[model samples]
Target: MDRKIMSLGKSSLVVSLPKEWMQLNDVKKGETVSFNIQRDRSLVIYPSSIKKSEEKEIIINVTSNEEEILITQKILGAFLNGYTGIILTSDNIFTVPQTKAIRNMAGRLYMRVMEADAKKVYLQSLTDESKASLEQAIKRMHLISRSMCEGAFTALKNNDVALAKSTFSLDDDVDHFAFFIVRILRNAAQNPYLANELHIDPLDCMDHQMLVSRMEHASDYAADITRHIIMLSGANQTIPGEVIELMITAGTQVADLYVKSVEAFFSKDVDAAVGIMKCRNKLEKLDIEMTSKAFIGPQKEAELVCGICSIRDNIKRISHCTFSIAEIAVNRAFKII
Candidate 1:
């Protein structure tokens, strides 16, 4: 059942809970509980004597001389799957080749080699990359995504099929950017010393590569939404201006989330990521509300609604993909802390 809390004074407040909750928890007039003030300004109450689970130790071993691609895959997979600690070891001192790749990967995973020996190197994960390449790549992705959104909006607003067609061609640019990221990763993985000389690690480079891939997919989704908009407009001979505006607005929100999420990922900003996720929910709600509005005729309404629905679904999926990338960033930040 729903409950309400109200402020009573400067320092005191009262909360009314369902009688059922009171009985289920065995609460009495004199009972006490713990309270927490959430970021959203809501108060949470809990039993004071709740039990907590003990933290468990986890260890993973990585051997030196492992292929860079294979090593990165292993480390990232382990990190995502919840390994608490990782230990890299070699029979002798870490060679230049092994050390460079390992350091690169460590940077990407937000992990550090806490202890090292001829036989073992213990790592503590952390998310901190104050590098130009990473920053630039994120910025470019935002710019490109925003541009695509703007182009799509223009096409939809003016019912310009030519402009809409142009938006599909823009996907080529995004693909080019993705290829650039792949090339960077390939080079870094192949020559660890070059990465070391540049003061970056192969693993860190790989993380940036993954970020690029996600952004590229975001671009693809945006393009597909634009293509659908074009098809709908072309097929119907005309689309309601309001419907077009609604789609443009939704597309803009998607772009905003894409940009903000990428910024949060690079900066390790959890609040920013959370904000983007909330905004995505708002966009989804807007799509639903707009879809419910009726059009002039049955045939027109059906076509427009179907097309808008497809665009809406794609936009939501794009927002979700951005959120997923943000989640990875948040997880990386936690490992560091």
Candidate 2:
């Protein structure tokens, strides 16, 4: 693993490549190699031929008894597994509903429906995983999810039904970015070339996956709060102003936690991660106060109380996600040091 630096001349220094690595890569004399500088200040040397490989392909055979939802699920799985080309075929013929489902599912993902017929349907991934940034997408995902929480609280405070309904649309944006990150991570796990291109190791991919999943879940919770808002929109009961302020305050704090934790994650700031933990204690204390106020509603205001309780719970879940991010950030920072 160690190579001595040798002087080629007064101006140049060189180190010999590892024999075992050269043999594994089928290196030959006069062949060129590409060297990439990593974020950790490490150099990676690889054969130029290994830069790109054939695209992965998958096929799904639809059966007569197979449900449309199950077929759509399988397509999603294949997409996450890094299959760029997907074929859906049926022994007899695709039903109208089945064809519709495949089309809809492909539309949902970053893939496009290339071709479709009674017996066969083709899907192609439009996203270039190599070009899609895993880290940047996750960072954006955190921002969007945090904003969803903030928007939900704002809508509740202003009694803006339209704004609450708009939050649900942002959920789709979260899914789009999350799906792209998941696909890239999955590909990076299976392909070393991709890992090199993405400048992330397999271990780092696993850590990122946890964050991506949490962000997805956080987005879902934000959307759930929006649903609760819509439900509470028509209710005549008035929520106490103090309780609403407390909810908004707690939600804003957790949103800030998300931003800080994610910043620590990429920057490897141990102190920032630790700060998130310190803030968590305060969030928990506020939760107790929010819970007691949640149960103080009368029968007429029970539905509104339920909405308030769900919003509080969603904010708590968002805070929990930030806690996980902070922990991961601490671990990653320690490893880096």
Candidate 3:
């Protein structure tokens, strides 16, 4: 990948473009290609302006015997893979159920049906990938996920069954944002121009992807804690007051740690990330104590213990996920400095 820099004149320096790249991009001697100086001080050459997005077409063959869910997944996969246009075709007329399913799937995505008939359906992306940004998507996920975590603790504190049940609904919203972020990262990995437009390299996209995945998992765990609370409430059994207070305290603290870790990542603050890491031991010890007390408590029904254990495991998992984010933040901080 290294090339020798040749002096053009008294001050100017130049490097030869690869012959293969020149041929592939149809570059002539007098033609211009764009060059960008990346955040890491690396230079990137593009055949055209990064603002000009590329379009991709994908054709999916649907079989009558194929299940609707499988077909839907294929359609979603193509969309997520950055295909700007998709055509779903079958040899025979699509069944009513199949047609309905396809429409539902397309509706859920950032696409619109261009044309639909008995044997084929055409869908085109409504999203302008160039206008979308990974940073904004990640921030949105952080806000929604933080709300989910907070909602779980609030439900537990008030023994509010309705609020606990609502956590699952919030988790669904988190899933949608996570899915969008993942799609953006996947697309960015393949399209350097798009990555540059987003102010990130592929490696940075990957790191942020890992952070998004962990946050999604943490959100799921928050919902799990709420689910267990709902179940316990339904059975007229309640967690001990001391244990409830402990769980709330631990969950809130872990949520704060997650917030700080994310802030460190965005700000490239190594000390803040390290500070979050320092709280890990205390969270782990508290997790152990919660488990032991839940197991040997005075009114330990199998069902109650099961719920307690699930909540304990998930709360612990949230803390671990928070620490993982801090770890990523620390790595990014070092790179930035």
Candidate 4:
């Protein structure tokens, strides 16, 4: 192959590819190729001409006598491994124990089953529910988070223990909404038509499912902080009002960052995702400051310090989860960036 030396800069050298080699590969000017660095620091390049792997159809067989719990695990496992279909059969007519068990389990898990014959059943994936359900769930999650933040801040500002306790209870709603999202996505992944209708790729849908999971965990953190706030307000004790205000401000900032990050993910906005990363960095700095001031001693100081540490840790974890979601959005919007 012909090669020509080229200058990259005053301190660097480069080489040009052979024209004949490019032509033989049917590569035109400006075509892109894949490149990688090996462990030995050698560079390897391949023409971007490889084809995608073909999707496979997988089938699972289950018998009527099989325990329902076992069948449920198998179904979930097969779906996760990219199975396209499943078949259930029995030597005799399906018994009430088996049918009833499967039906109960399917309803609980949001899966669908079709009886193809006396001894055979077909299983399909789940999907997102009607638009009303989706919209309502999203709204509830937002409202719960907003209320929790408001209650926590107001309680801290006014030293209202009752309000703080009430805020902690709101975490139940956040957790419920998160579980609902997971159930919907799990169902969608099982049914081909529903998955397609929702525009969710079975594999890619896992990321969205995880985002919801992390948000729930973040809410748990928020609730934990509020609980501590309640404790401090009672027993005639308090953190410096200014410190409490700072913690509240940090928590609110993190919540806003998480919401924007979720929006960026849904909209595939790389710029917004990057903005979230910046906000997370700022939150981290504030956490460090809160931790330092939380440790000054009295009889209750240790408990208060530990509680502040836990709150900061949870908030930082939430930020990290938000960043993970943002990373997915960035990858989608700019594949090579």
Candidate 5:
């Protein structure tokens, strides 16, 4: 709602607050309200008493026939909708799979299972939304995903099955961050006060939401690369050294580009972001050259060749994700510029 500006004195100007808002907050003529000047120079007025809002609560009724995947989605849906208290109820008792699914999803969402009985389970989120840092959380998310790419390539380079196995667990960490970031962004999108506290506008929230999704996807490809690596690096099955070295070098280059993209995003460096887009040219050329020579030398076994190609494809997919990230970085930098 718009308020008419009134001259208070020679230099001061004032605007009256809406009566409806004042009444809702129980503000009287003498009581003071608080306000914050947002980054865009807009003011957000709120009650001075600063009463905490009650956490949103949701209930999920679990039937014996409920699909585990559906249960997981229900919990995540509640979380994204800004619910902090989730209760799962069953008519009888939860099956082992049902209980396990709830526990796993609760852990992933940074929630604690506060209580569980034969017929019901209660989960509460651990983090205080008002105090969480969106930037730090996104940074942590990017760190894990970027590390996953590097780790996957390194695992392939060294033929370390143990290291390759870590991609699974690392991907889970990335997922946690993704979920956390999305939830925060969703909250910020709906609450202007929260957005000001988080130092993000609606546009920033949209960009972050998109970027987190890309990071999650890139991490998935990175994990896929590791799975192929594990398969090809088996004792009885080895891809040629020439093939491995080529894949490693190119994959590592992709990881480097991924790093540059995220750095450009953080720094708001338009030049660096544009440069990342150009660097992909060389990587793509290498992909072409490598594909041509993939069957040459000792790199010609049917199974090994297929596995090498799959790994290469996953690496290329990651590069695509990086390119999208750089594009977003360029746009974000322009917003500041």
Candidate 6:
């Protein structure tokens, strides 16, 4: 992998390319190559033809009565592998459950059923990932998920089943962005040409993914909070007034902290992350207070106490996740300028 630098004239230097690399790229004498200077001052030299990589296409065979979950996983795998087009052919007609699973997964993955019949299904990815903006996508993703978290707390305070359902439905929207961003990151990490187009180095893919996962986790905990709200509402039960007040106060603070953590992450503001992290003790104190008060209501109503505790625990989890995001923000900042 080492190439010796040789003096070419009075003030120039040159290093020859590896023969194996040139042969693989079909580069011959008189051919041109492209050189890109990375953020770390490393040089990325490649043949001109490598500016664009060929898109992948795949076909998966579905066995008779194939597990619906397996089919969905395969479809997701194909999409993550950078396949622009996926064709699924079943040995026989797809069962109703199989078809339903495929349709649902398509919605989640941003793929559409372009062509479908009794035994064949064709899916096309919706967007050119290279052209998509990673920052904007991640921002939108965090924004939606943040709203989900906040709404979960709102639904809990109000004990509104309809509101909880609406908030729960937004998790799908979050996944849409999560899946799209992940697909883009995975593809860019593998294809340097695509990485160039995305304006992100390969290392960025791993960092962004970690942050995205925490965002997703925060939203998932929030969704759990809403589920507890919905169950309590359906059961005609509610939290103690004291517990409600404390839980809402704690949840709101956590949600606000989550928002600031994401902002710090995108801005790479280490000071802001440090400031946000300082608020963790407040969450711990609130958790302790919530635990004592959550058990004070309805001695015979064990369900009510359990549900209130569940909601409180979920809020605590959200705060923990938010703090982790702040920590990640501080780390991610150092990787940049």
The digit string of per-residue lDDT tens for model 5 on 1-337 reads: 7889999889999999999998888999998888888778878887878534357899889998888999999999999878989999997789999999999999889899999997899999877777988889888988899889999998888888899998757999999888888998998888777888788999999998988988999999999988877776673577667667778888988899999998888898999999989988899888987787777764356667778788889989999999999999989987861
lDDT of 4 at 64: 52
Regions of candidate 5 where Cα sits further than 4 Å from its true position? 7-12, 23-30, 48-53, 295-306
Native RMSD of candidate 6 (Å)? 2.2
What value of lDDT does candidate 2 attain over all alpha carbons? Answer: 0.84
lDDT of each: 0.64, 0.84, 0.84, 0.65, 0.86, 0.86
Which model scores highest in TM-score?
A: 6
Lowest-sum lDDT 10-residue window in model 3: 46-55
Instruction: Give lDDT tens digits, candidate 3, residues 1-337.
Output: 6789999989999899999888877777887788767767777787763326578899999987778999999988988788889999997889898999998877767578999888999999778766887788889988988988888889988999898888767887787777777878888888767777788777788799899999999999999989898899888888887788788888889888888888888997888999999998899888877776665646677778888788888888988889999899888766651
The TM-score ranking, best first, is 6, 5, 3, 2, 4, 1
What lDDT score is found at residue 82 in candidate 6? 82
List model 2 lDDT by residue over 228-280, tens digit each. 87887777655677788888889878877887888898898999999998898
lDDT of 1 by residue, 1-337 (tens): 5657789989888868677767877777777776655333445565545311112234545555566676566655555433446666665566666666667766655567788765666766442112226456557756776677667767767777887788888887676455544544554454333344334455566666667778787778779877887778667645566666776777677766777777787788988877776775688777776677535346665666677677767777777778877876776567421
> What are the TM-scores, per candidate, against the unseen true structure?
0.53, 0.85, 0.86, 0.57, 0.90, 0.91
Which scores greater on lDDT, model 3 or model 4?
3
Give the poorly placed runs of model 1, Cα more than 4 Å off.
Answer: 1-138, 294-297, 301-306, 335-337
**Residue 107, candidate 4: how far off, in angstroms?**
14
Clashing pairs in 2: none
Q: What does the lDDT read for residue 212 in candidate 2?
A: 87
Clashes of each: 7, 0, 0, 6, 0, 0
Worst 10 residues of 1 by lDDT: 49-58
TM-score of 5: 0.90
